[model samples]
Target: MSTDKEDLVVDDDFPITEEDVEPRIEPAKTNLSKRRTIDNLLEERRLQRQLADFDYDL
Candidate 1:
């Protein structure tokens, strides 16, 4: 048995896409160590933004 191309798609120029590229993302972030890592990264980003804002205001 073989599959047909026309049965699969409406247009070649544009194709439908899914909301999630990763199958299971929430489970990966649920770990305690992973959450802590994310928190630290966010704090560093916030500190950098504050410094940049202060420099522009002067």
Candidate 2:
């Protein structure tokens, strides 16, 4: 669902042009593209294994 809001008004002589409306902008990415270190990958794998372990109380 989009959270953007736009107003719709009915006008006979309304001059519609591209300059009147704001340009659609893409969200900027915060993280830069960089090669991952070996230690970082190993920690990620450890976390994934931890989450995969399931314990039932039944």
Candidate 3:
């Protein structure tokens, strides 16, 4: 039993080819803008709720 590094055998067909992989797709700009708008609205509502729940008495 030899523990040499070069003892392993690599197959030529084992490497991945360009055709076998799928291209990465990015989200549309409109969708991202809409998400940002929704996020801002939600944050504003949260802040308003926090302000309403605060006690003003010393």
Taking the tens digit of each residue's C-alpha lDDT, what string does model 2 give over 1-58? 9788988787789788999999876544422222345568888999988878846554
TM-score for every candidate vs. truth? 0.43, 0.32, 0.51
Hey, what RMSD does candidate 3 come out at? 6.3
**lDDT of the candidates, in the order given:** 0.76, 0.70, 0.88
Top of the candidates by TM-score: 3
Candidate order (lDDT)? 3, 1, 2
Which of 2 and 3 is ahead in TM-score?
3
lDDT of 1 by residue, 1-58 (tens): 5665565555657655785355565665478778899999999999999887785644
RMSD of each: 11.9, 14.9, 6.3
Extract clashing residue pairs from model 1: none
lDDT of 3 by residue, 1-58 (tens): 8677676676777868898899866678877998999999999999999999989996
lDDT of 2: 0.70
Best by lDDT: 3
